[model samples]
Target: MNGETLQLEIKDNIACITLNCPETLNALSMRSLIDFHASLKQVIASHEVRALLITGTGRGFSSGVDLTAPRPGLNPDDPDELLRDYFAPTYQLLKDLRIPTVAAVNGVCAGAGVSLALSCDIVLAARSAYFVQAFVNLGLVPDTGASWLVTQAVGSARATGLMLLGEKLAAETAADWGLIWKCVDDDKLMQEASAIVNKLAVGPTTTYSLIKRLMRDAKNNSLRDQILLENECQSLARKTEDNAEARKAFAEKRKPVYNGR
Candidate 1:
């Protein structure tokens, strides 16, 4: 993974990934996106990382794709194939990360950037931050799962408004609309994100992983199906080392030390 465009660091069982090309508002160049996927792979493969935090440097999380860069649709290549090979993999990796993932939106989050933030298990934004679909303004449709994520987060009506108008949604307004988890003071964004991720790092990670999968499947699942899935997951959770540790700690009247088993 190239560190120039994407800064990555791991500490205390949490991996912090930052989009580093601030001058371009951390826009995703083809190479940058590749490197980002590589970095995510490294984190996902590591046993030491139990949680992930993603953000960006400077005043924007990302302006989405670098418009000046050569992109797929411009060429004769099938756009669907291009998406499947290049864009889809990165998004799929994020969705299947199998760990608690958090997105800290520090500034302007737009276009595919909106999808990036929404891909996380939890999304927190700065009070000054704003989200924009921005696709219609560019005469392009939403990509990188933006359509699905936004529609699911908000309803079809709001999703249509955001996508069609491409207006800016302030962070506070986003929270009120249930588009994000919460909006913190701009200065406290990183501090709050760090606190949240640090708490997750030592949490019952196996259970968290299960919860992540279930939550994603929840929307698509029937009530009976989800209940059955929950039972199975709970059964699996009971067998995890963390569950045993918690039980032992409870019996001993001590705080449980979770190694993210």
Candidate 2:
């Protein structure tokens, strides 16, 4: 899928989706959001797409919702409903995707942009990248799941500090705080992210999906419940052709070729 605000490309079982409005620092324009959902839907429908990566095309990952752009005609007192309608589907789609998703943040991520980056399964930020919660500065609260994602990654204290103070966290500092997976040099961000996606693409995709499900739900489940889930997942995983092929390959001292069964 292609659009004025986004670019989508697929190669070797991996899809790369780029927020393409570089002139606006790839801010979350309405068209961009719609295009994002369409691209994600296409990727999720592709059985061959084992992994996906998202990044921006210019100097910044994104600056968040484009305040200067025209939005839907909603009553000023009920703006929440309009924003929700535009953002929720895409956010839900990202969370529901079965295959792994990576965010390669090449530069600044602020406001809803921070939410977008955090929505991915793994986030790789460039060394020069920065994450800013600019909502408070504009007299707004974090939206687009930023509050939940930030707290999930960095705990309430740090998330609160970021939202309240409107401070920017450097990528390295974010990594140290467990807010992102890793921070590579600016020039290496895409390459590193590609390597990660490539690795995940060749791995046990079903196991990865199960692990993702379990991790996302673990906080709400008791230990016994989690154990039962794990046991069930393991049982299902063992029945896959890849599992047996892996075991046979080990015994034969040969490489295993997975069929993603």
Candidate 3:
């Protein structure tokens, strides 16, 4: 949390994480990745955190891994092993984070950076922002869960094209391709992402967690099983005070104040 590579701050049940390595275009370094993962786990375990927002501190969100950093391991010759563990934590933390996460991409997101943005529950990119899979250009394959996450978001064919061609997809084009949630003005990205996080922070916490789990499991669940799972979730949700307040507010023709119960 005290590292200069990243900054983490919590307020109003929302944790904001900013990747801070502007000189290197906020490139993902090993130490930074480890610190970020630790910080995320801390926030997720804390009872006060309800939502998370991740962004960058410079012009670009990130240029992907910091190639200048020293490779780890006894075999100083094995670059493959080093690359495998480089951004491993970044990918794992995103997938394991229980709280709803949002990515506010303000600029260029290349290589593993695209995967990082895609890992978030919702990705809000600025008009000036662009996504690129520069791995092929560098004579490397996609890492940090990019291969799966990218294909999952935009399908296998598009993912293949993006990775192989190393094309830079603009924010609007990425949105059109269903690669990101939405695109806004250069200056409004953070504001819009903040509003979304505020909404989730005050909404149904338990139901949101359940819905996240259900959706992830949907990839493997049969239709009948999914229906049953939904039934169970709904049955549980209906008993919460937030649900009761919703019904009361509807009957009274007023807005409900959810406590995220």
Candidate 4:
């Protein structure tokens, strides 16, 4: 499926969403956000999709929101309504997806684009790709969950520095700081991402969903509560058909072929 600013394609149970506005470095205009939300809904409704990959075309993942684009019904000075109405819902949907998500960041990722990449379950960036919190440069603060995402990945000190300084962070440095999952050669970015996503697509879907929930809730939960949550998730995972297949395969000394049950 294709939208005005985005393209969605599903092959082999993997759904790929590409930001297609390369002319503006794939900037997220209002239209793009609307299309993104719609595409996510389509992914959710399509039971065939087991994994999702997000990336951009041309030289950048995204240059963040299209500041140059005209906002018809929004205040020119304030972006409050624009973010709440257009950006937040799409971001929330991405975060709440049951399937695994991978981000292939090819080039510049700035402002809300940084947040978008970080929202994925795994973020793999090209060697040449760089991230920047450009909000400070524009005299604005980080939005689209940038503040929370960055701080969660790195600690408060580094997040503060990155956001306040608004400096370019190389993909390697980002990986070193644990801000992203990995950094690959520029030419291998998509290849590496696809390999991981393909593995996830065929793996135990229920277990993966449970893992995502556990990790997402871990930081907020106390140790006792976290353990209880893990116990609950493990109980659910143990009941899945994939778990039984895995056990049978182990006993037979063969690799398990999961049906994503």
Top candidate, metric lDDT: 4
149-169 in candidate 1: lDDT tens per residue?
A: 999999999999999999999
lDDT of each: 0.90, 0.89, 0.86, 0.95
If both were scored by TM-score, which would come out higher, candidate 2 or candidate 4?
4
Span of 10 residues, lowest total lDDT, candidate 3:
70-79
The residue ranges of model 2 lying beyond 4 angstroms of the native Cα positions read 72-77
Q: Estimate each model's TM-score.
A: 0.95, 0.96, 0.92, 0.98
- Show where candidate 3 strays beyond 4 Å: 71-86
Query: Predicted candidate 2: what Cα RMSD to the true structure?
Result: 1.5
> How well does candidate 1 score on lDDT at residue 49?
94
Best by TM-score: 4
User: Number of clashing pairs, model 3?
Assistant: 0
Better structure of 2 and 4 per lDDT: 4
Expressed as tens digits, the lDDT of each residue in 113-208 for candidate 3 is 888888888999999999999999999988888898888889999999998999899999999999999999988998899999999998878778
Ten residues in a row with the worst lDDT in model 4? 70-79
Residues 76-157 of candidate 4 have per-residue lDDT tens digits of 6785888998899889899999999999999999998998999899999999999999999999989999999999999999
True lDDT of residue 124, candidate 3 = 92
Q: Each model's number of backbone clashes?
A: 0, 0, 0, 0
